[model samples]
Target: MAESNCTQVTEFTLTGFTDNPVTQVTLFLMFLLIYLVTVLGNLGMILLIKVSPQLHSPMYYFLGNLAFVDLCSSTVITPKMLVDFISKKGIAYAGCMAQVFIYDLFGMTEGFLLATMAYDRYMAVCHPLLYPLVMSPKCCFQLVTGSYLIGLTNGIGQTIGMSTLSFCSSSVIDLFFCDISPLISLSTSDTTLSHVILRTSACLFGVSSSLVILVSYVAIISAILSISSAEGKRKAFSTCTSHLITLSLFYGTVFFVYLKPSSDSSREDKWAAVLYTVVTPMLNPLIYSLRNKEVKEALRRLTKIK
Candidate 1:
């Protein structure tokens, strides 16, 4: 295509989940409920961690940050998604890029935070005596800060890469939001740079963070097995169950959606995107609180005070 003939796309129309009016209404109600739970659950978790003296520790500290990331991630996508279900709104080019940047920012940060939580678990389970020294307040702060910094870098790289592409082909996004794959597909210009950036960011954040979690859990499991008493083993392993579940839900959907060979967005990809983006945030707080005795106790204390 000649540069002179290329028409710059000013806005992109988002093709949301369904076209049927009944289905759209049904999905809207369901997603609205999910978003409500997500917001309240994540916000409550953060507040609980902040106000409860009992929850003051490296683990809960990391949990609080995770809740904040989940909140931000869900907020960035769900509100727009809810609006789209009822209305046909066109996202401006700048708005689309902003959405991509913000979504990737929190998404990448969540990956690193999950890994950091795994490391915290390993320290607690494997090196109980040294955990306090190793994962001190300063160290914890640095780790959290590092996660955000890396996430910021990824967001900038991805947005810049997407910005470089000229969307002269079409203005309609197949999926509900402005994602990397969908945007690349819409670009008339060469998408090699965008693909490179996408793959590099995925490998850097996805593989590296997953490796950290894997290594940490390996040592943790080994330490748990070393405990002679059955009760001791159960008690030690119980601490990790919630985190393991949360990790499985998060990474499972993420890997399914992004790590696949074909870049073509499918129905499965759209639903899987919902799992990581909408459902996971709402589930995290419940998983942690219901399984954790300390968190339950903290909640009870909070309720009594109220």
Candidate 2:
């Protein structure tokens, strides 16, 4: 029987947050409402960016792409989570693999895309004279395309690596979705290589992209300081406040959940998952719209037109 289970984990149960009847129903309703807002906010941001002529720039272009990624990521993770909450919660092996691939596809893409946007901002603020030529529409497309391709490659590698492993023991996943870390922890097979590969790849994708964003902000700050007028400096810095806040919120939760020293606590990690997987996507559009004058003005114009 052990050998048979090793050959294939036909189905894996998800030990979602709670099993209490009332608590489960309450959690289900809450998550459903949050998922709806996430969808609407991300989709609305994309639609507004598309229709507003004033937003036809590299910044807005990248924002639309970010919104698309957020929307897809939330959709990929949340609906299935909701289903698991309300019904028998078991996913086939293939289904779990698909979840990991799709979730990482967007998650990694967003990491690199945020770095790309930081670079965009750096060029715009620090190298204004050369920004037009350096960050041309073609370059924007290539950057976004390259980020997606990298994410695709990462997702494929993660899926293939996961498929190679065999699960001979307990097949219960103690998380909301098919997070790679928790899934690997449940594996009975020797996972030394899998752990190394996942850790290396996560660092390569997460830390490297974060480094790029950090360097870009350094340059942006230097440029902002060089400005002669106080208002000019404030204007330059204000544009980045929203992105900075988003970056902090994202990296903070992810680092805590995936990279921190105490990350082995799966019970605590589920609530952290709620943060990045649930809360962040819903807050993104609101953050950008409320913090950005351009987005707010465009939204006003759009409302008046309607």
Candidate 3:
């Protein structure tokens, strides 16, 4: 905890999942493909939402924000990882810190954005008559802005907390990318405060967002079941199924990655990292677009498909 104990390291080597050249190249190609999909998918989602008049709604607005967050988050980590696989030069200290900040920013953004979307669905399914008034344009903008602001505040707190810890001697970080847990585990200086902040933020961002999503859905499900007709119930549930699946995949992977202690890094943690960082980004747009009939119809109109 003392300032004198802080030794400043200039850079950190990334101990990626494997060391074999063949494996490295393979992983490089794999992640390269994934990054490409993430870019195109999220980009297409935003563009389609923008141009399609039929797609303009509170739900789509939140989806656009989610797409942007997924795009940014994947861009922050995957590209650097692919380059590191080939170059093996590792990231500079400032670069690693920036990666940590940007990645977490978008990660937290996606969590809140998903919660926002859940609330959007709740209003649509449970309060259809008042949905338009309650979730007005101004209200929607505020929700999106609030999600980004929350994400920004959390990123700043984590970065400042990390800056206080002095990394010395060992420059090798144990994850594929610069992450909070691995960085803290590799820190040579005192990290009691850093650890406490990390745990608190994880719970704050992860658990709180999850709780909001769960509560929204509880009300949503209750409203759906009260409908008289089977067709009505099916139609009501259909609107939220995509979001529920997205929430499950994103929050499940996040909890697995961050809820536990940092001292407990394993091969499983690395793979779990892959799920959130790589797989989730790529899957989100797919989940929303492929499952939603409205999105499908919008895409058809966008592409001039019959």
Candidate 4:
């Protein structure tokens, strides 16, 4: 009966990137450009990988999936955020939850997929003789399946956690979109369990995935150094450097945002979100393709396709 005292809030007012009209306009335009480029770039990458037989390896398979994740993740957050900037009102509770769920799905998938990619790279570079046996199509498929399994588990768990919390009071979320932290803050119900769940989820999905990638790369770097031929070493290093760069940027921002305690004035949180959600997606195709002559050639051939 005491729990019935809770009031139900239908909508949430978003305190967007900035309250300043000028800043909002500027951010809107900038993010619009970022979103457009992210879509074009990731779509193009996926298409290129799909069409090119040379890109049919486990590495490219994961890269294509990564592109897919980036595209979906950006779609979840950026467009609505853009609308929020232009429109007077913001997102509703249901809409926010839907976005949050999808965002969690894609983001969590990306983390797991990246770790899987690292393992793929580890086999390819560290044990080239066994690469064929290790990275068979079935194995690759299993890896990708495992990633989605993790993503689904995380998404459903978080979504349900969010759903159980009653947002009966102020629904104004002080962010561009509804995130777990802000949503938890808005809930009228006690969020102790929710917070613990979220923190545990973060560690399981985010930190654990990053650790797997880190360890895989550590082994990879060692293997690269052991190559006696300078040319062999150069080629091996080049193949992985771009991936490592993207990995660093993605995980760095993610760890900074999720692993740390929340502070309202934390510019790092906003910037980290931008980095992982907007900037990373836009940059992935370029980073992966520019370093990959095969991908560049594939794009060239794709453009020339009649």
Candidate 5:
């Protein structure tokens, strides 16, 4: 009986932002512009890092990978979301599950990458003499590969937990994109195990990574304070200011959405989702390039060569 009921929901109707034609058109145009900028900006960052000899360092290497992740994360959701604004927003169960898995994959990877970046920054600031040895090419590659591996594991676990449940209730998800909370609300079977999986993964990836960032920054700050000159202090802080901003933006909205109970999720949660999912990717390149002198110089050099 449960199997038959679960099989009944082949498709889900997404209750997107608005039903008004004018509003939809307006939002569609806005999101389209954002998506275009996101694609161009992240791609430009990656290309600049690739071609610029000045950017051939451990820092920029990680940065290039970050741009790739941001580009992919935005592409996964923004195109479908833009289409939903114009047409009837319906998604097959398989498609929805795919979205959930990919979304979780990128989301978790981004968090781990941020923590890795924090550790990189800490090494650079706190141990300048040993930075090259400690953060060698092999080490950096391993860190990034580990981040993706962890993300892949979490994605598989979450998707399996979600798939085992029976969505026999209503087929309407009250968000712009598919997420664990909304899907859990629609399940007819007991979701205790699923919730446990969700919370456990959240702690394992989210909270643990956050702790890594916190500890790294604390040591970073201590080392910066030990600098004898004001100019030296300023330079040290400047190196990480952009990363600090990006981390705050990404984690702020993520924690707001995921840390709370599903029953507590509301329309406000959707808007918060928009921040990390859509807006953060768009802003990452801007924040990094605008704030970092090295990136700006690389852009100028590349433009002259072109």
Candidate 6:
């Protein structure tokens, strides 16, 4: 029996959405715009929340953290992807690993953050009078800290698993960045253990966070229906609706990419990946900020101050 000659990949080539130069250029421009918007929007959100005392609450605190995560997450993957679109070689092995670490960190962090946001909304809308008591500063700190801890643990586990895997042969990654799926696919050695670890990690972090969000929303909807006044119900629903939209966009695309069977994954599926990684991050600020009067008013006040 011959030993598999798998060593660390020297360099990895990225096959972004297309090989056509024209299409690549067009896609590059589009993603550039999305990336720019994601950066500015998220930055603006963080600044707005920081400067506006009125926006300082458990809800905005979570929202600010979400914006920060989205910004960093988008930056981790998109900039490299954009450069890869035009560059001769996409990324080196070290660069790829760095991407993997950062991408996983922020992605997992956002998952936990989303769940935290859901819980925050649940407390605020369902138990308005007790919102302060339930989501006290201490409790809010615990929730945010917990979110970071969960994400950090999962990210470290996944990164360690990926680091152990040997990649000797074809170092070409089909997708835009060094995603776990593509990395696993590219490995020359037996990947059963790695796959097991990956699946377990996914279940531990991805599935559990999603389940928590789902339960929170269910309780939230129930609470909303119990309200007697229609206007009151509308007002309550509006607060969390943007969060729901952002959550759906994020989890939907992630589940599609990671959870789906290989048989179902196609070129089109890669496009779907773009929706969450690129499009959704940019849309989050718009969804949360534009729709919320508080954010708008804060922006207005900031503008007037300027």
Which one is best on lDDT?
1
Write out the backbone clash pairs for model 5.
none
Tens digit per residue, CA lDDT, model 4, 74-95: 8998888888787865787899
Better of 2 and 4 by lDDT: 2
Candidate with the greatest TM-score versus the true structure: 1
Q: RMSD, each candidate, Å?
A: 1.4, 1.9, 1.8, 2.0, 1.6, 1.7
TM-score of 6: 0.95
In Å, residue 187's CA in model 4 sits off its true spot by: 2.1
TM-score for each candidate, following the candidate numbering? 0.97, 0.95, 0.95, 0.94, 0.96, 0.95
Superposition TM-score, candidate 2 onto the true structure? 0.95
Which digits, one per residue and each the tens of the lDDT, describe model 3 over residues 169-282? 578887888888778877877899887877788788778888888899999999988999999999999998898899888878777877667567688988998999999999
lDDT pick, better of 2 and 5: 5
Per-residue lDDT value at 264 in model 2? 62
If both were scored by TM-score, which would come out higher, candidate 3 or candidate 5?
5
Candidate 2, 35-152: lDDT as tens digits: 9999999999999999999999999999999999999999988899899888999898888999999988899999998899899999989888999999899999999999999889
CA lDDT of every candidate: 0.92, 0.88, 0.88, 0.85, 0.91, 0.85
Error of 5 at 254 (Å): 0.7
Q: Give the Cα-based TM-score of candidate 3 against the true structure.
A: 0.95
Candidate 4 error regions (>4 Å): none
Model 6 lDDT per residue over 1-306, tens place: 223544567788887777799998998898899999999999999999999999999989989999998998899888888887888747877778788888888888899999988988888887889999998889988988888887777677777777777787677877887888889888877788768878887778888888888888899999999999999899989988898898889988887887788777689877898898889889999998878988988998989954
Q: List the residue pairs that clash in candidate 1.
A: none
Per-residue lDDT for 156-205 in model 5, tens only?
98999899878766899999888888898888888998889998997888
Which ranges in model 2 have alpha carbons more than 4 Å from their true place?
Answer: 1-7
- lDDT digits (tens) for residues 195-278 of candidate 1: 899889878887899999999999998999899999999999999999999999999998888778765658888899899999
CA error at residue 240 for candidate 3, angstroms: 0.6
